[model samples]
Target: MSAESPGRRLGLRGRVMLTFALGAALVLLLLAVSVFTISRGYLLDQRERSAQRLASADADFVKRRLAAPNADPRAALMALDPAADTILLLLRHGEWISADGNPPPAPPTPSLLAEVAAGATTLEPVTVGELPYLVVGVPLGDGDAFFEFTPIIELRSTIQVLGTVLAACALAATVGAALLGLWASRRVLHPLRSLAGTAASIAGGNLDSRLPEDNDRDLNTIVTSFNSMVDSLQRRIERERQFVGDVTHELRTPLTTLVTSVEVMHRHAAELPDRPRRALELVGSELDHLRRMLDDLLTLARTDAGLHHDDEEPLRLVDLLDHVLAGQAATPVDADTDGPVLGRKLALVRAFTNLVDNAERHGRGLARVGLHAHGDHVLVEIDDHGPGVEPAERERIFERFATGRTARGSSAGTGLGLALVAETIAAHGGTVHCTDAPGGGARFVVALPLDNTPEDTIE
Candidate 1:
């Protein structure tokens, strides 16, 4: 009925790491693309200039040879040989001729021929045989045109390799950014984690717990503020404990006198009227109730003041319960406590006494008290034949002076008995909760961890 719900949102650490990873990826991708694009354009420009220069020189040489007094144009064209990956073509009288044995994969385009015939030189990039090529066209003095095709396969390969390397580096940088973000998040959240731990210790009654000194200016400010706050809170608690101790001493004398006077009056009841005798009994009962309330309050004050008896040695859960049950009036119980449990003797004795009294007073008398082994813990369960706690008020009843809860209904016996039980058990690192008993009654289960770790005290 009181199960906790888990958070579903991404934590601060996850968000921080994702931010770093995305930011690095975006920036690196942009940089990689820019470098690749710029390098590709510059390299292609240089190749075009080199190809144009080589083709222009060859065209000039063939033109001069044909222009000589005894020149034979066909012989001159045949003598012009180009490299393996290059193809040379000459246009005369509207016919195309190859200067070398190897012909171009595609014939010269009309655009290149028209531009050369217009007395203009042209350098055009085109695709031939599925490979990149630069076509250079030069017009001759004899109304012919010269064309050269050069393959740029090596330049394309270099650009492709560069692109691959940049992509890999960008991917690596993204991974490195994620790792960096994780480290930074842990480093930044360390102080907050410590603060939370210290707060929990203080809430669990360790008044002396404080944040450690920090060298960072901002962190040191928080450390100083937290320690100062705890110091103030501890001082106020100490003052309240002192007031309770003083009040206990001051009230005991008058309370003892009132009880004595009531007892003396009740002894002479047979001689008095019936109404007077009944009134005297009522006065005596109320006085006893008041005295119990005061005692419960004093015990709580002492616990908060850190006045618990020390844990001398490890004690088995069964032996401890046996000692508690043996000293009291006979009660039916089902015992199975077998493991070592760490606890303070006096505090645990009072806690068990309160549990028994609570069941008898609130739950129509104690049905049975039993112990069971629960893996690494021991459970001491008390059952009573009374209506079980309401599901909505189950957790509220554990609070000190809880407002309106059916878990500890009807404020009988000082309203502090269940609270004391919770406190004492919590001090020993245990918990007490209310649930439905097997026979449709109320069950109070005290779960105690079986820890044999040596300690100075229950605190």
Candidate 2:
């Protein structure tokens, strides 16, 4: 398999440190290689130059000794030797000679010795028996010769040790860089963690929680923006709540008067004319509308205040759907199930009832109700054979007072049925959404956490 993507698999700190460590190690390796390569060449060149100077001067001293009459050239060369492990070669009558170091039985050809003895310079690096050597050839007086060889074993050993130490240092530095990046990332992310906690608190019904202010310019800007957003949200929610409350309060007095007048007219229907009695009937109908509106308002208030109770228990979803559907006038819906779900019994019942009622009012009728386990959650779906909701307005229709029927001609409903369903499901720590049904029309699905233990199973 290919390597795991760092972005997908690695945590923030791990990714940051791994990237830094790899980059730093690569840089260190490149630097070490360049420095070592360059230094090796420079050290060899310096050694060669030193050997060249010493050999040239020593050859001159040997020439001077041979020039003095009656002086032994070998003895003179020996006396001039101020260093150990030296060699001296003299060229006489086109033949090569050496003193103070061993030589082969046959010296270099006459042309080669003449080339060296004529001061034709040669400075080249050579290796013998796996040992590095610097070879320099120099001329002596009138066909005399000198050759110098300096072993570079010590220099090679020093360079090798230096390279090893540098490599070790680079490795150590890479590790240090990785550790430093981890620490830096943690410090940098601490403020973000705090901001996340604050946002989560606000989401969990704590509107007063606010992000802490850090002096960092970027962080301060973020904190300011977040607080502004929360403020706007809180203000809007309060205004909507006040409007619902005021409308409910205003409708209460009119409703009471209408109800009292309708009851009186109903008792005296014989004395009152048919038209007046019909008007009284209209008043009773309007009273029903007012009561439903008030109840809707109260439900919205309770949802907003987070007042829903969650007494979780085992619930047989299929049995529940069968019972609710039996109460409806239409053909009983198909209630199918594979397993029970765990949730608050009363709230879930209310939610299911609202969904079924919504379908009955708007849809042709309820088509089916089915339940099954999906991974760790239990899914309950209600299918309705109605004109399916418009794709764009599906979510909007769940808002309070948002009805599927048009203002012109529509079924009378409080328009809070689906909204209540949404809220109740949320209180039970479940999710609800609408989509196209399998056969046709709309389907509403509620997914709640599954609990299959004996005590958690429905009868």
Candidate 3:
């Protein structure tokens, strides 16, 4: 058999969960990006507006002080309030002056100072060294400008926290989506699993197996269709089995008469010519083969129709096997083990006979036949000195009409013997299988549940 591809081997549930997780992650990522972008813009815009207001107010205070009669430019710049995290720069006559004690690492750029000198106000974000700040410049009347630098470390921290929270939420949402996918997949596939089980039971010869009624519309439709199909298949199989049973039943009387006539011819063979005697022998042999085939077909039909004539009785398995072996020409090395089984005598006898016949035809001959009790079961092992069965073909060979590559020695089997044996044993709640025997041959083992009850008797 070809191996399945790895990519295709993922089950439906896993695939659904993966898809849900991917979709949820994608949505959450988009939402996170939108929220971060909008919040960051709002925070920065509010900070910039507040800085512009403070700078404008400080510029008006310095302008009023500078307009005084004995105003000193440096002292007037120093009169304005400067917060600890804020720096105030005054540009007068193309020179920058600081209102606070500490000055900026670098003075304002020429392009920015020129913009402020041309009667335009500038509010922009700037970074100095490792710290982020907002720069707001306002042009004061008469060739001077006031600038404020406000540190924005708190805004940066708030945005970082928001990003971390959004990421965590996205992760949690992805996990939730996976869990939801698992639950949904199980709910969806439950009916399918039931259908598969019902189909398997039907395949295993339980024709009555069926799906339960469901309230879901789609599932109900499927269940109805599946049950209807099984009903039709069961009816068709029953019809075929019935036809075989009826045909074989009708042919029995004629076949028996033919056998008797051939036997009479064999008795009077001395009166016939050599060629005519050979022809009679061939006819008799063919008729015998045909008779056995018909009997097997009748048994199978009855088995299929659940018509078993089970006269349950306590049977000594070793004695029964010895009797069967004695009936055959080649006597196997038999072992007498103690075990009693509750079963029908005729059916068990026929089943063992079929096994012996199969071994003789397919294998060289029976090498050993033994019976033993193990726990609550009795095992009968029939060993044959022939080419052993392949592992793959062992079970298939028991199926009706299934032939394997084995030594037949000149005898072609009807292929129904082992199948009949299997059916008979199964009816008695037993199992039979072929395994490798000692000294390189095939061994057929039949395991029947032992019945040690004191009330055991023939019915």
TM-score of 3: 0.79
lDDT of 3 at 203: 82
Which candidate leads in lDDT?
3
> In candidate 3, what are the lDDT values of residues 82-179, reduced to their tens digit?
77777777777766677654555656677777888789888877888888888888999678888888889999999999999999999999999999
Alpha-carbon error at 292 in model 1, in Å? 1.3
Candidate 2 C-alpha lDDT tens digits along 1-459: 998875868788788888889999999999999998899889877888898898788777777887889877657656665444434555555654566544533344556555675668555555656666565677765656666655677888989988998899999999999998899889988988998999888887677888877789978888899989999988888788778777877878877787787888788888888888787788777788778768767766766765556666777776766676677655454443445666766667777888887777786678877777778787888888887777777787688777535311234677787888888777667889888998998899988776675853456
Q: Give the TM-score of candidate 2.
A: 0.72
**TM-score of candidate 1 relative to the true fold:** 0.90
Clashing pairs in model 2, backbone N/Cα/C closer than 3 A: 89-145, 91-144, 91-145
Best by TM-score: 1
**Which sequence of candidate numbers ranks them by TM-score, best first?**
1, 3, 2
lDDT of 3: 0.84
